[model samples]
Target: MRMPEAVTPAEWNKAHEELMAKEKELTRAQDRLAAERRRQPGVRIDAEHGFTGEGGRFSLVDLFEGRRQLIVYHFMFAPGSKRPCSGCSMFVDNLGDPAHLNARDTTLAVVSRAPYPEIAAVREQRGWTVPWYSSFGDGFNEEMGVTVDDNDSFGLSVFIRDDTSVYRTYFTRGRGVEKLGTNWSLLDLTPLGRQETWEDSPEGVPQESPYAWWRLRDEYGD
Candidate 1:
């Protein structure tokens, strides 16, 4: 949504005044957090933890697919686990095209403790082409602390590798939810943005915007 142009000096001043301080604070905090993220201690993967994809088996390094950085979203999708977390489903629902992400020199993939077939079925149903893999065979999901028994929750993590060595760069969950983008950054500027009856949107919430019209990849528009 295009923001209304500030014609008057007062309007422009008011806009900058509203969040200038807060924006500066946010930027500083983000910068510090990113620096700390880059300094995270490495967790080596020595055991045989592999994921199965369409082509064949893939080690954790293989997931990077020769990229400099790898980001894995631990998606909850076990067979007997309670229903898929609506929050995660909603998140993946809004992910921009994988190709867009790929073009950025980063590889984003979903890892689940569920079997390959189960994850594959859900991917097909959701019509998402983003690369997903099953971490069912190995203790990868369990070791990552995302999987508990038959269920798993979501976690965002980054890893890097040079030659044959793998290093965990960063990981975040829960309070880190803000890092996941749902277009709220854009919607927050609108008068009727993200009008989910849930949030206390001061501008009366966005009511059923274009994002709401988005559907699964293979799903047809109504």
Candidate 2:
């Protein structure tokens, strides 16, 4: 084989641009992959998956709560654990009311392996009011592929259904983590918003909300 040619500065710039184009292309392709998965034939939940609901007992279908779309965020909160996954906590911190998603016929819920009693403690500590349910006696988390002992801590997954059928639309982890935040999505609008703090602005920076004003749910009123 012939020896590879050295990359001149000009050639390096060309290569960088080409690589960026391919990155954008790949992002689009991944989005298309999710779309195709959503289009797959829905799967019927024939086996009963148990859960402890506020109203005694409930099954997996009960989790759907009368909606065409369902998004179950598998929160890592096994029994006896003091805190859930920090990365998972970061994603949950970004979530807002499901009403907006509800308007589009989607229902969202956070499922955890912890018993409701333990799960409730954290919910109160975090001041989160999102609909949460316990899967203490069920294999729901394992069946969904989010149950990891110590290796694969947690993951974000989206599921959808129509009538009586359900299907897994998509799931992601690791560097795909950025997909969980709405703040970064907003920062991209301005010339200088991510605050890197050490960042220097040439023509000054945009003003509006002070970053310090943001607070965790538990400390919101304080």
Candidate 3:
């Protein structure tokens, strides 16, 4: 394997400074992108998607926990599967404290299509605190475009509230969701990101089944 060549201090400093300039430029561009995303009009969430958690059955609005914004990770815990999705599990592990998001009037929750008791046991065993819910057989996953037929895929959906009415602000799937630490940042990447089957992506852009392409990171080559 090739390694970076050792260089004199002055050469290294100059190279680092050059890279920093481009990084800063990228940061500014991201700021502009976020400004535009905030302006994008939202679509009303009319589907009666039901979710159940340890507390009991709750409407989609309840997932917001009274926050104005709600970020949901559509975890790929397919029904009757004995193991949770490795990729989705790692995504939850990457999340920081929910309190910080809570302070900003946002709540991040993990939703899956598995039974409540089933997912709860996994959550407890894994020692995860982030709110999790079961959308089992309610067609919520199908509506969100995360589950196509027998395949189960992972994605992120963001919602915001206006007085008791809720709207879907954004959603993303595939690597479109990579490297995003904050839910809002991830959602802002596309107006209707990741053109995948089962996705409500309007006409325009190529798409395929949501659960067809992705695999555990290490299994990609297989």
The collision pairs in model 3 are none
Off by over 4 Å in 2: 1-34, 41-43, 148-152, 181-222
Tens-digit lDDT track for model 1 on 26-105? 97775444434434467876776889876778988889777656778787777555455677777677777544333323
lDDT of 2 by residue, 19-118 (tens): 9999999877754444344344444555668888566667666777785556667777887887877877777788875554443345667888889988
**lDDT of candidates 1 onward, in order:** 0.65, 0.62, 0.77
Candidate 3 lDDT score at position 42: 86
Q: How many residue pairs clash in each candidate?
A: 6, 0, 0
Q: Model 3, stretches more than 4 Å misplaced? A: 182-222
Worst 10 residues of 3 by lDDT: 187-196
Sliding window of 10 residues with minimal summed lDDT for model 1: 185-194
What lDDT tens digits, residue by residue, belong to model 3 across residues 60-172? 99998887778889999977898998988888888876654554456788999889999989999999999999998798888888999869999988887876798887788
Better of 2 and 3 by lDDT: 3
Q: 1 or 2, which is superior by lDDT?
A: 1
Q: For every candidate structure, what is the RMSD over all alpha carbons to the true structure, in angstroms?
A: 13.0, 12.5, 12.4
